[model samples]
Target: MKRKTIIVLVAAVAVALTLVAFYANSGIQSPKQEEKFRIAKVVRRDLGASVQATGIVKAMVGAEVKVGARTPGKVVNLPINVGDRVEQGQVIATIEQDDLIARVRLQEAILAEVKAEHSRLAKDFERDKQLHETKSISVQRYDLTEALHEIARARVLKAQAELDVAKAQLSYATVVAPIKGTVASVNTVQGETVTTGLTAPTFIKIIDLDRLEVLAYVDENDVGNVKVGQEASFTVAAHPSTDFKGRITSIYPSATIQDNVVYYLTSVSVDNREGKLMPDMTANVSIFLDRRKGVLTVPNQTVQREGSKKYVYVLHNETSEKRYVSTGWKDSSYTEILDGLKDGETVTIGDPGRK
Candidate 1:
């Protein structure tokens, strides 16, 4: 009987510990605590809609050129280096021209001898023609002399043409800058052999830095909204905070395809008077589409699209109410409210107490 009494007291102590643990877990929250929400009041403000795209800075068309050698020769002189400024008609490089000069002199001598022979043949032809008219010589002999005179005249013409060609080939030994620009690259150096055949070897590259432009590849959908003369602003990675302004100058007709998606190349004329931007630098561009003034606006996150319909949450007297809203122009951050919402009206932005 004493053992049974001891067992009953231990079972009562275990039951009391179980009841205390259950009450400790349930006492954290009370039924009177109210649910909280994040709310924002609608306001009127000016909003600008913009299309974003990435592009590379480039020199204008015809402003950049790859200078090449016109004839095969050993490079004897390279007067310019990378980043050197050159003007039109300036000799940037020269090839070994000793052989070319000798060829020119040889052709000149040949042309002179041919011209002297032609002069003598012409006088003989005149005398032979007079003798034939007076019956002083045979008709066959006069015909022979006439043929010899014509052959001499042809030789003179051929020699003159050869001389001109030789002079032209000699001129090719000197490479000149075709346009006024800065030398962006030097592909060849002194003593390098350049062989010109089907394609001339490139010697240098000159580009006009003053005429800088940006080629922005806008997506196919957003390209329709972009037009010539539209104002655009861009920032490069080197100067992220500084905004450069430009205007749309052209839109290429061809579409560039990548991964089955199409993009149109648009050209923007950038003003680089300060000379800070460099070629091949990437630019993040924003093309302004339109600006709406004094429009009722709300945070873009507040509105949610349900298929073709859009709706938002409205806070009325501490109760969350779902209401449909008609929207107009929208930007990256805010959306224009056309109807179903007024200025200074409270709207629920997000669910509270949820992370």
Candidate 2:
């Protein structure tokens, strides 16, 4: 045995130097394992800065009214239908009032036959003015009895103006409801015979669902930062998880193109007193402008712009640095830092040329 093969060739060269020193210490790394970066902190709170229109919900200028039939007739007592609700004077429909109560009783019998011929021509003009002052009346029979007492006082003022135009055409056969709404549409049915001509044919269309309003359109490059009272919010499509709050009362100075894009209608208001909002529906607005309470924020993907200048990195004790900030108001995940950043400073969240 040549000394047992030199002790097994020195244990096979000590197991190939312990497998090349454990693969060169696992291919070197350490420094907290090459830091893998991804941090945040520099915060403080509150931030707003919005403006994203696209609305509809309308109905707020006299809140949709309509109601028609100013005299024609026939629908006789149509009570009310389409969603009813009414109130402001109620009635809602009832035309053919027996030929408007026979023209208000034929103008109250021609105003009681012209007030009984004006009380018999005022008693024959006071007995010919006392027989024409005792001269035995003969000044052409006292000027024809003072022109027959001024033609019976002009036939009692034309029969009291034809009995006040037959009591205003019998109060236009009652149709009422000038507001306080919800009816929406009726157009006639009970006996259907509506006919008015110069416009009063609507018959019903109320609507005041708590006076809604949203309209929003915007986008004339953000309608110059939309302002009127500011602060707003919306979201409808039939209450899509409800958000509805409002303010920006108006802005439409005209400009609404479409397909070529132009917009600018604004408005906003809406409270809808919990009626769940309606009319046209479709909102999705925002508005909010500028608000930055507490300040010192960060996270908007850790800033980092470069052309118009804007930066951030600062991680310290572990390394990162860069910095350069001076933001203001961003929202949608923070930004508003204003100066080089400090609050709790830590920043550094991704692609700084990704390791």
Query: Which candidate has the top score in lDDT?
Result: 1
Q: Which predicted model would earn the best TM-score?
A: 1
Q: Number of clashing pairs, model 2?
A: 1
Question: Which regions of candidate 1 deviate over 4 angstroms?
Answer: 1-46, 293-355
Cα lDDT tens digits for candidate 1, 1-355: 9999999999999998877776578764332322322567799999997767889999998989988777788999998989898999999999999999999999999989988998998999999999999999999999999999999999998998999988988998998999998899998889998878667667799998889999998877568878999999999999898899999999999999865667899998999878788899999888888888999988888887665467888887767788899887667778788899989988876643235
Tell how far residue 10 is off in model 2, in angstroms: 33
lDDT of 2 by residue, 245-277 (tens): 889987989998876677888888989887888
TM-score for each of the candidates: 0.72, 0.40
The lDDT, on a scale of 0 to 1, for candidate 2 is: 0.80
The candidate 1 region of ten consecutive residues with least summed lDDT is: 28-37
Q: What lDDT is reached at residue 187 by model 1?
A: 85
State in Å the error of residue 104, model 1.
0.3
User: Which pairs, if any, clash in model 2?
Assistant: 68-203
